[model samples]
Target: MPHRIAAIQKLTATEPHPERVAMFAIAGDSASGKTTLTKGLVEAIGTHRISSFCTDDYHRYDRKERKNLPFTPLNPECNYLEIMEQHLQLLILGQPILKPKYHHADGTLGRPELFIPSEIVIVEGLFPLWSKLSRATFDVTAYLDPPETVRRAWKIARDTTKRGYTTEQVLSDLEQREPESEKYIRPQRAHADLVISFAPVEGRSSLSATILLRPTVPQPDLHDILTPATRDAAHIKLIRDQDGKPVDALHIHGHAPEAASRLVEEKLWEKIGLGGDIPASLGRISSTERSAPLAIAQLIILHHMIHC
Candidate 1:
């Protein structure tokens, strides 16, 4: 009996622990499509297996309070970075935390709530990858790099419609935050494993997506999926990164034929080995509108979430 008990303990020790969790960080400047991308991922992966929140909730000041401060919220000084780091560490260990909340609509801080970590955790916002300590908590990280014009337009639309900001106020705030954005926000892109950009394809209202895959982490092998026959829908090529390093850039044409894009999506879904139809929510831009490029991007990220 004693020998059998010892053998059981040894076997259990080698088995995968149920409490192991994977954390992902999606960091970008304001209105750079961070939340939208995160939303699609959460939906695709199922919220039961995912817990997501915005790091913006750690803001040290409300909008009214920031009026007296020299720096905008984009500055690290305006957020509770230390506390955020602590919470991230806790979540990585499958622990729960009482997280603070900041309401964007009224620019007010709300009561803290208990947040339990799931199998996967996605933290998105301005400073998820701000420091080495914070970046170390995530298994994977992605940064949104939409063009300035596109991001500006998105900010104006979202702020005016949802955040109670006028176009003039939004524009002025963007101008004021530019310096901080340049200093604090853009620099985080260098630390991300994937850099994603969505821009308008000429003559097409939809936006094309370009994803730069860095070798910091292992990415899916797309050679078999993106072939000459499907080149119009998506393709990959070697490109020089900002630091002059060679990286693989995957481009998904927003204007490609639906069938062609769907074939690529199907192949990617097969690689995930989830064994079901793709989630109806994969590329949703709105309740009624969907973008193929957005869907493809989300699938690629989903693959990393499960396999990384």
Candidate 2:
């Protein structure tokens, strides 16, 4: 994240604010591995550095409660959005926030968690970046664009295995989640600083993460920035627009042209301005690294958590 040029004017408040706490967000479609990514970011930086929550926790009604209704979690009307916004504001101001816990398996709200002051906050979920107020809370924001086929497959497996849904039950839930997705989830990509999507080509176990790094921030170089996690999975390339502007895209797997991959990596690493051997710790767990979709999510969240 670039240094904040915008300044906050002093305003009346009951509690004194802490050093302006930076907030970052991850937004994506259902079953698109948002949780997986968020989990990793929390892991990379100890949870203490980041107090995180999923927007799914703010659903206005539990799944069972909403089953009778025509809409599901995808619709903004179905979430306690104003409350979520208030919570973010509190967290940003170095204040305490008592947050509700959602029991996804049972579709119920659990006890409230005592969230004390934190310096960095990571919020993840569908439409996490949708609303202007919510978007304003983040110093860095991401939009995940995994293919629907991959997302659906991941969702089906996850719901059946973890949430105890039968195959058919999972399918039905997916169907119910779709209408809201089309209406609300897919339209918020334009506001993000980065848009990441994975495209897996045939015969390759690997996949490429198509990253659109918007030119709105001071772009970091990927070279010195290249940890083992990124270097091993894919090569980077730069894609130039007709007007001679360049957009960086990573070729993680499948069908990314060699020329493009070469283009992106050079520019990305160049931005980082680092020299000497790369960090050996980064790819240490390469063999055990999570799925590309999940890894991509982690990388995105990690970017915001640290940069923001």
Candidate 3:
């Protein structure tokens, strides 16, 4: 029993922080919308004020080497997790570090880049919350828990177009990586203060989002953001989570009418207490398309990073 307790403490040991920088973690499996969710927050907070990096950069093996290794990149053994923990501690204390760069376009490691800590730092990748010590570095943590069907579709599209993989190759790789994802990635959700899930709306082709706001962390009161009727009718809801715990489940319908989405956006901006100069382009994932749900989700996260 004493030996087991020592092992647990070693896994969760954290250094006392001297400075508090707002750190946020976005953890999810491959093609789980981790980057998509983070893009909007980067824009909303302004890139100059935010220091963001992908934790996958800590990968111990490049693409070629990973193929020969028994364990996939999702496993902690395949990553420099101890180094990552050290860097996270340094960043929280307002210190800079030399960060390794991984070039995804060609599956190669680039030269290390100097990273200076900013007012806010956002770290996103598969294993940001894999260890308790690393998870302790973040002021806020979110896990993307999209439905598997949706996630598979996103993976196929993203890998084929961006990563130069064929549909068949991506599918096969996903199959091989599933066990690792279940073992390391999904378990991190329990450490998150928020879980963002995007699923296809029934009878609709577009995807909507449901954000699970855990009571473990302080959340902005979106319920009273608008008037009584508007608040009640708004897309957000306060419901009990699956475990019979009271949680706020913010639903942003993809097929919502223009007027309704606009109303919600305006109310969110009001809740932000920011001036009218807030740009509409903050949440756009692509050049031509924008998701109100994505924007609102970014707003909710930004509120925590900025105010808290």
Top candidate (TM-score): 1
Total clashes, candidate 1? 0
Clashes of each: 0, 17, 0
Q: How close is candidate 3 to the true structure, as a TM-score?
A: 0.89
lDDT digits (tens) for residues 1-308 of candidate 2: 23332222323443454766878777898777667656655655566766678888888888678878888788989888888888887887777888877787877877888877567777888767778898887888878888888888888988887777898987888887887787799877777777777657767665556677767664444654344444544556788633466777655654434444343343333333334422222212244653443344345445545554
In candidate 3, position 235 carries an lDDT of 58
Off by over 4 Å in 3: 1-20, 226-233, 236-244
Q: Report the lDDT of model 2 for residue 149.
A: 87
What are the models' TM-scores?
Answer: 0.94, 0.77, 0.89
> In model 2, what is the error at residue 28, expressed in angstroms?
0.9
Across residues 126-151, which tens digit of lDDT does each residue of candidate 3 receive?
Answer: 88898889988999999999999989
| Least accurate 10 contiguous residues by lDDT in model 3 | 225-234
RMSD of each: 5.4, 7.2, 5.9
Task: Write down the TM-score for model 2.
Answer: 0.77
Q: TM-score order of candidates, best first?
A: 1, 3, 2
Superposed Cα deviation of residue 98, candidate 1 (Å): 0.6
Error of 2 at 200 (Å): 2.1
RMSD of 2: 7.2
lDDT of 2: 0.67
